[model samples]
Structures are given as structure tokens and as C-alpha cells.
Target chain A: MSNEQRPVWHKRVTEAISADELAEREALWVPLTEEVRELVSTAILSEVDEHAVALARQHIRAAQEILGTKVDTGSFGMHVNDEGLAWNWGNAATGQKNAVAPPLCQVPIADGVRYEADFGAGYEGPPGCLHGGWIALILDHASGRAAHLEGNGPTFTGTLTIRYLQPTRLGPAVAHAWVETRTANKFVVRCTLSTEDGVTAESEGVFVLARWARKPQED
Target chain B: MSNEQRPVWHKRVTEAISADELAEREALWVPLTEEVRELVSTAILSEVDEHAVALARQHIRAAQEILGTKVDTGSFGMHVNDEGLAWNWGNAATGQKNAVAPPLCQVPIADGVRYEADFGAGYEGPPGCLHGGWIALILDHASGRAAHLEGNGPTFTGTLTIRYLQPTRLGPAVAHAWVETRTANKFVVRCTLSTEDGVTAESEGVFVLARWARKPQED
Candidate 1:
């Protein structure tokens, strides 16, 4: 559907979900998820409109070429509309091609968002420490969700600061994210990750200039 | 053996070994890989003193705690030292307790260090991108090796900064590390990670306050 012709559920879904809840909803929103997957796949196949798929493919190929190998264990999926188009490419914790990630998929909800996943070995950093970068990934996703919730089109990680309070052990961990403030296209997002007992990590970030790269494709 | 009574080789091994081939008389001067492992393990276990057996038991318990649980999978085997002390708590990429980690093991080279390992599907981020955290873990290990080489005693990562110049893919990758500078108890280390052809990641960091933490016994 065209941007103006898109359904309201897209907006509702984007606004009503938490990062954790959205992750849980990945299976439930299979139709929407599949729709995005198909659209992006088709766009890439046709080489027609300049879309997120084109941009992602370009980047992915650049990375692969530089690294000198084709990575088959991962993929990028996307969906589009006037409210915004979202693309999650080769997400490590949840990509089909990723052998070292936790299983993760996210959707939209309310003014904030939530995400949850179970991680196992293949991400070790310390003797028993979870590689710190995985922690940053979760934070970045949460920050991105916070931006998405505030309608900040799309943005890149301008700066990210993470504190390793304790060695994050790999296991089932849950994360929650949401917008704390917004100004023009700039947004402040607050997030937290926890397991069954207490919090494992906390994060907050500022996302700016939604659609900074290209005006949220006029659809 | 107590610190004062330990074999002279124990103290000599930590020093830099010459790269040139050793004659039979210089054999003791050459650092053997197995010997180095034993020495470090011995030094690490030295702190346990009378608690060596208890420490081994803890290692077993910690390993058992994660095994067959939802988290134990592609991790490395952690064993105690000849001093009969063990530390299987966990590691970022490949500790026995870190379920989300990969298999990482250190090998002592002529005068520095090298690491070997394989990664799989679960650690993806971005599309086909290795989760940023996985990169950090590899970098951390590389940096840590640099610290170990400078003979700066075991050090904690005071701070680590990583720039994701490009997304990393899964599969076989190699990392090499060495010391850049040393100041008293502080040592500066730098390292890099590469695929088959060229460098993919580079890291630099400071390792300081040698042996700040007393052995478990002293604590």
C-alpha cells in the first residue's frame, strides 16, 4: 500500500508496543512481518524504486566485499508506509544466518517499547562474562525503538556509552525501552534489561533528525 | 610451591623469550606453550593457597550450574591449574559457563599471543552483521593479551572503546595482540582481528595497577 493508503494498525502497532512486548509479538504479527519481508525482497529483486532495501543491500554488500565473503547466516527485512518504514538487517540475536545471536524480533507499541530474548554461548567475553558488545546491541536497539516510538523517522548511533556494572551472563534476558522526551526530530530514550530477578543493564540515548538521510520516503 | 619457593622458570617464563632458535643450553630460556599455560595457571592459582581444592570444587560447581541448563552450549572447557585451583566462572566468547559465548582459547607464541575460534548463527546484529558486542569481546581478548604480554599482571578492563568501522560476518576469524607501551604497573596494548586476507578490527587500551586485587587467599 502507498504511504497515504497504509492502514492505521501500522501506526497503532508502532505506538502501542514495548520493545519486549514487540519482540514477543513477532510471531503474532507474522502477516505484517511477512509483508515487510516480501516488500523488501521484491524491491531488491526488481531494482526498481530506491528504497531501504537498496540502501541496505548496498551497505551489506560493501561490508561483505571488504570482509571478503558472503555471509549467508543473516538477512535484512523491511516494511514501508507514510508513518515510516522499518528495516532490521541481519540482527545478530535473531537473524536466520546468525549463529552467535539471541533470538530477537520487535514490533511497535504505545509511546514506548519492550524487547526480550534468550542468549546462549557463542557470545562469551570474560571467563564468564557476556561480551560487552552484545549488551551495547540491546541498548542500541532499545534506543532505536525509543526513537521509533517518538516518530523520529530513522537515525544512526551518533554516540553510545555503556557501563559494565557486572559481567552480563548469557541466559534469558528481557529489555524495555521508551521515549522520555522529544524536540523536533531529536528524542531521548530510556531503557533497561533484566532477567527473572533484577536488572542486568540500563541505557538512555538521544536520537535526532528522523529521516535525516532521506525524507521518510514519500512512499 | 610458595612464591619464594617456586621454580625459577615460573618467574622467568613471564619475561619475554627471544625469537631466535634456542640451542640445547638455551632450551630453558625458550618459552614453551604448554609451560606458559602452566605458569599463568599457577600464578592465577597461587592466590588460592590453602583454598586450592575448594577453588577446584567451585569451578566444578559453576560449570555444573550452567551445563544442560538453557545456557550451556558452544563454550570452552575451563580447568584448574597444577596448583589444583580452577576458575570456570565464565568468559565472554567461550567460558564453560557462558552459554552465549564462542570457543576461544589462548596460545602462547614465541613472544606474544594468538587466539583461534569459530562462531555460528546466533550472534547476528544489523543484517548479517556480527553483533557489535561480539566484536568487543574479540577486541577485549586481544587487548587483554597485550596486557598479559607486557607482564603487567592480570588487569581488568578499566575502559574499552570500539569503533564499528564495518560489520563483521560469522565463521572463522583470527586475532593477534601485543604490547605498545608500559609505565610502571600500567601497560598499553594494541591488537587487531582479521579474516583470510586483511585486517577487520583494531584495538588499543591501557592495562594498569598490576595485581591490584589480591589473590583469593589474600582477600
Candidate 2:
């Protein structure tokens, strides 16, 4: 669909999020997302007693009903369209409190975005290694963020290439991304994943600026 | 660590899982996992009332305590060593009931492995598109599975390259992988992601047989 004809949600990009709002939203949601991640991890790893399971189920059901009554039974709208919210907060790679997130925190650097994370048992692939897919997720997020910093409007990933140099141990790790090159509507970003030991993975991604949302001058 | 000296858990592999056992385990866990995923998705999207939040917290605490008292607290052991259970069940990409999972079901074709899945709201990225990271995750899993089917004992992803041909919509999609080439200890696998429309993404991965766990003859 043409950008002009697209839904309001599609037009709602990071440009709509202010720095102050991003910080505030991150502050409010980060802790909650972390708690949820903890809950998910514990729930999966913990061997629950029958009584506890029953109690938990009851509580969840009650919460669902109460929330259902009080809140509109509507789709959790597109992340971008959510007013004053950081889309990354609900993301699976870097969302702070999202249950599905590895719960990485993104820190801005001079060149691009950097992330610090600990891939817990919940994201294991090999015996004691982090899942390769999760590695890609982190790189993809970081690279996209880097591309965004290039001062272009929202962009979509066109291609991503990842090299797993070694097994990423399941624990604290670091990732960094920076814009490598930029053309008319494409940004090539490079990212790396490392640990105290050394680099574990590296990635390069091509992010294409949405054709419909392209800058007027570029057109 | 050398294979012989490595921990027992490291030695555990899918080959050890019998077909009957895998089936029984899948039957037992798939539904439960799906329930958990639903709970996770709902928890994130639902807006809670103050009273409901308090009640939910209390119930969660009680359940945690009860489960804590009745169950031994320890890290969930390595998946491969978890008897006949499929580790993929709780995985974020291909897991059946994981909220983060696209829940791609892998089916064996003559040459390699194929997967069919639907990218739900939980995995959305660019407006109506599937997250680029998710596409990478699916490709990684499929390629690795292809490497495994090549009669190799076990493999680790050495590198993965993905090209997105078009936006993968948030609905039913398909993926396939096959061993493109094999060397002494490495298998090059190629994979593709597609919808009814056409190919959306393609990937090439270099899977290296784990150093410590090479087949005797190959070694």
C-alpha cells in the first residue's frame, strides 16, 4: 500500500517518539518487563507443586477476568502506533520487561547503539551456549537501531549476514552496532557480539528506507 | 573440552531420543506450552486494574512459595539430557507453545527439513510484516536441522547469511532447508522463507560439527 493510503499506525514511526518520552517510557516499562522475564524464566525452570500450580492458575484467571472487564478487549495495537511508548520495550531481544525478551538494555554510543545482556537458560541452544537465533535477534535489533540513528526515517531489514565465530556462552555478553555505509535509501550497518573472552558473532545488515515513507527530497 | 572429557549433558543428542518417546513427550507438552504462551501474550497486552494487580501479585507470590517449598531449586538441566523431551518445545523460534515462537513445525522431506508456520501478532515487526529477527531465527533453525540430517552427530552454526526478498506478512508462511555442500567437518546449508505469494527471504549457513563431538570416522 502507498504510504499516503497506509493506516495511521504505519505512519507512526520512531520520529513520533521524543527523547524525553522514550526515557520516561523506558523507565516505566523496563522494570515491569524484567519482572515478567523473571517470572517466565522461573516458571519454566521451577518444578511446581500441584497446589501451587492450581493457585497460580486461579490467580491468573481472576486477573484475566478483572482486566478483561476493565480494559477494552482490543488488539494490542502496533508497537509504533502506541503513543509515547518505545517499540523496543516490547521487543523480544531488548525489551526490558517483556516476558519473551532476553531483557537486554540498549545504551547509546557515539557511533551507534550498544547492548548488554545475559542469555539465561531460557535461550539455550547447545549445552552451555546461547542460541544462534537469539544472536541474530540481537544483531538485527542493534543494526536496525544503528540504521535509525543515520537520521533516515524508519527502515526495514533487507538482508542480514551473521558469522558465528565461536560458541556464545550462556551468560553476560555485549553487542554493538554502527552504520557502515548509506546510499539513497539503504543503510548498511555492522554489528558485533562479544563476551569477556572475545568476539562470538558478527553481522552486517542492509536496511531499506520504506519507499512510501521516503524523504521528499530523495524522491 | 574433548568429547570424552565433556560432561554427560554435552553428549546427549537427539539421536538418543526414540521416535515413540518423542511423540509421547510432544503430546504431553505441546498443549501445556501453548497455554503458557497464551498466558504470556495476554499478560503483556491486558491492562490491569489496581485491585486485580494486587490480587495477581499475591497469588503469584503464594504459588512461587509453594512451588519453591515442594520443588528443588536448580537450573533447568540441558535440554538434550532431559530424557526424551524435545528442547525445541520451549525454544523461542520453533517452540510449539512459546509465545515468542512462530511455532514452526518441522517435517522431514527427502533431502532435508521443511517448516510451516504462521507469524502471529506476537512476532510482528514492520507494520504488518514479520520481524526480520524472526525470519533469521527460522532460517537458522531450519539450516541447522538440515545439517543434523546429513548424518552428522551434532552441529553448531558457524555463519548465516539472510536475504529478504520482500516483507513476510503476519500469517501462514513456509520455510525449507537442505544441505548445499559438506566438507570434512562442515555442512553448508541453504534455506528459504516463503508465503503463497513467493519467496520472502533466503539464507545460507555454514554449520560446523562440534569440535569436541565429531564422529569417530570423521575425526
Off by over 4 Å in 2: A1-32, A49-55, A68-89, B1-30, B69-90, B94-102
RMSD of 1: 18.7
> After superposing candidate 1, which stretches have Cα over 4 Å from the reference?
A1-90, A95-99, A104-113, A117-133, A144-159, A167-213, A216-219, B1-78, B81-92, B95-121, B148-154, B169-172, B176-219
Q: Share of real contacts kept by model 2? A: 0.32
Distance (Å) between predicted and true CA of A61, model 1?
Answer: 32
**lDDT, model 1, position A44:** 14
TM-score of chain A of each: 0.54, 0.77
Q: After superposition, how far is residue B114 of candidate 1 from its true place, in Å?
A: 4.4
Error of 2 at B144 (Å): 0.1
- Among these predicted structures, which one has the highest TM-score? 2
The residue pairs in collision within model 2 are: A33-A97, A33-A98, A34-A97
